[model samples]
Target: MPLTFRKSFQILPGVRLNINKRSWSITTGGKNGPRHTHSSTGRRTTSMDLPGPFGWRKTRKGGGH
Candidate 1:
């Protein structure tokens, strides 16, 4: 199995800093609101939670997904 590493730090009430082996990202937003993320590898993502198991996510990256 492939191994992965990740960690998150809460900077503020609605802000977070996430780090992985290859890159890092900052996310801002609340649970009931739309969340936005931008990574160090030129990836931008916006996601939102829905009523149940349904949710929405859109991601754009400079290199590949």
Candidate 2:
């Protein structure tokens, strides 16, 4: 089955924060998803979800944090 656990947050006028099972990314553009400034994946631990800016955190495994 397909994973539909994606969540998005607007950080600015045309910038967004995207969180999914695979990665957490910052997308910048209009209407559609981000087309720039995508970061590489990293291993995430339990402490990564302590609330703050998720953009500064590492990517987690499984179905998001």
Candidate 3:
């Protein structure tokens, strides 16, 4: 199996938000990743300390999946 590193952020316990950049930025692995708001501030990494609205679970549209 190929190993893939996914840049993700955690808003709160059991909740994480994946980075999805539309443009090329240094924070976004340059072109392939999504640009981060924390990266523009000359920060090597961004902090993912926040509260999540929903628990750790995949959100489904319309009805439950």
Judging by lDDT, tell me the better candidate of 2 and 3.
Answer: 2
Flag clash pairs in model 1: none
Q: What is the Cα-based lDDT of residue 37 in candidate 1?
A: 96
Among these predictions, the greatest lDDT belongs to 1
Q: List the candidates' TM-scores in order.
A: 0.90, 0.46, 0.23
Which digits, one per residue and each the tens of the lDDT, describe model 2 over residues 1-65?
Answer: 86578888999987778888777877666633324435336333322223455433333554354
Cα deviation of 27, candidate 2, in Å: 0.7
Per-residue lDDT for 8-61 in model 1, tens only?
999999999999999999999989989999999999999999998999999998
Native-to-model Cα distance after best TM-score fit, residue 34 in candidate 1, in Å: 0.5
What is candidate 3's lDDT per residue for 1-65, written digit by digit as tens?
95655466656544445543432113222222332333322334422322554222222333322
Worst lDDT 10-window in candidate 2: 42-51
Give me the runs in candidate 3 sitting further than 4 Å from their true place: 1-6, 22-65
